[model samples]
Target: MTKRIRKAVFPVAGLGTRFLPATKSIPKEMLTIVDRPVLQHVVEEAREAGIEHFIFVTGRNKAVIEDHFDIAYELEETLQKRGKLKEYQALTEQLPPAGATSFTRQQAPLGLGHAVWCARELVGDEPFAVLLPDMVTMPAPAQRDRCLAQCIEAYATHGGNIIAVEETPWEEAHQYGIVSVGKDFGRSFEITGMVEKPPKGTAPSNLMISGRYILGPEIFRILEKGEKGAGGEIQLTDGMKTLSKHQPFHGVRFDGKTFDCGSKLGFLAANVAFALTNPEIAAPFKAELQKIFGTL
Candidate 1:
């Protein structure tokens, strides 16, 4: 029987140079997308997919990221004293039990592949999910579940690895790791090839690799021998490419809005889009937008 996927690794070691000054002290993953931090959104998605063990591959100045998941005793006690039980419940709702989560430091800024490789010992021979906290998908029941759960299901059924993908414009497809698809499996496709940031107009397909992934343990071995690609960083795409040669690989077309929180424009857009969904803020935010546009 296939070992059920129970663990997930989150690579949160990126230096958010894009968000600069603000990120000087704060880890980008701790930045909020509405009310919750970006990492919270990623963790909720993983939980929905039945991931029980959460492992974070952290780096310098990322202590806040770990504290975010740890219990805030004073705050919880204060809320209880004030009869803000709902608020307190909300905060602790997603808190994983002790030992269910682990943190390991990625001593160097190698790349996604290296960060994941750092968690190899904890993962220990089991397939696991890799969720980059920098990406946030809007809350949509089936769509949210589809992104993570579907990847895991595909990994199980296909007995290999799976990456979440979504369509991108052909011209801009080169900006991402593009997937060469074979047969369609409804919401996903069999990945025949993967090209990382190929030159424009030369990409295999327009299906861009999104941030979510369900990887087999064999990938740790591939990553161990993986060389840096595209940028000077050891790209996860490079490791996955090698794994594909020996095992089945597929791409799930996750039905959801993915905001690239790693970029400024994408982050601003996500904030606005998420705020517009709030009952209290939506009306005021819409009015402000109208007034600003009218003045322009």
Candidate 2:
């Protein structure tokens, strides 16, 4: 029987240099979209996917993230005194039990592979999902859970690692890790190989690897010796390439919309999208947006 995937790792170690000043003192993961921080969205996604253990790989100045997940006792008490029971309940629901979550510091500003490696102790030998907090998957009922469940199912049937893929513009495909498609299996594809950010005209296919991944524990062994690749950082793509040589690899095209919250435009877009979808906030938010844009 295939073991159920119960743990997930969120790599929140990035400096978010792109969103400066705001991120100067605050970790990028703390930046909020529609009142909830990006990391919260990621954790909620993992939770929806049946992830029981949350592991955060962090770096300096990221304590705010830990605090965000902790119970805000004073705030909760204040809300209780004000008789805002629903608000208080919603706030408390966001706080995870202390021991249910773990944090490991990534001492250096290395690449994705190094950040993931920093959580090896917590991950141990289990199949785990790795989510980039900078990527916000939209409000699908299952969202990250659906993606992970699909990967878990695929892993059981095929015995390989699964990476999330999404179709991108053919020309822009070169900007991402492009996958060479083999036989299509409806929601996923058998990956022949992956080419990392190939030159504009040389990309193999339009299926770009998104930031969500359900990898086997074998990847940790490959990551152990993972050499620095493009940009002189230990790229996870490089480690996946090495692992592909030893085991079967597949790419699952996730169904939900993905927002690249790592950039200013994407962040703004995410905020707007989320606000529009939130029932309590949607009406006023839309009215304000219309007033501001003047029917543009």
**Pairs that clash in candidate 1:** none
Candidate RMSDs in order: 1.7, 2.0
Candidate 2 lDDT, 1-296, residue by residue in tens: 66778899999989999999889998888889988888898888788777889999988888988888888889999999999999998898887766889999999987999999888999998888998898887736655354555556676776668888888899788788888999988877799998889998998889888888888888888777858988898889989888889888888878777788998998999999999989999999999998999966
Clashes of each: 0, 1
Report how far off residue 191 is in candidate 2 (Å).
Answer: 0.8
Q: State the C-alpha lDDT per candidate.
A: 0.88, 0.85
Tens digits of lDDT, candidate 1, 1-296: 66788999999988999998999999999999888898998898888889999999999999998898999999999999999998999899969888888999999998899999999999998888999888887745444364787777777777678899988889889799999999998977899999889997899988999899988899998889758888898999999988888988888887777889999988899999888988879999999999999999
| TM-score, candidate number 1 | 0.94
Q: Estimate TM-scores for all models.
A: 0.94, 0.94
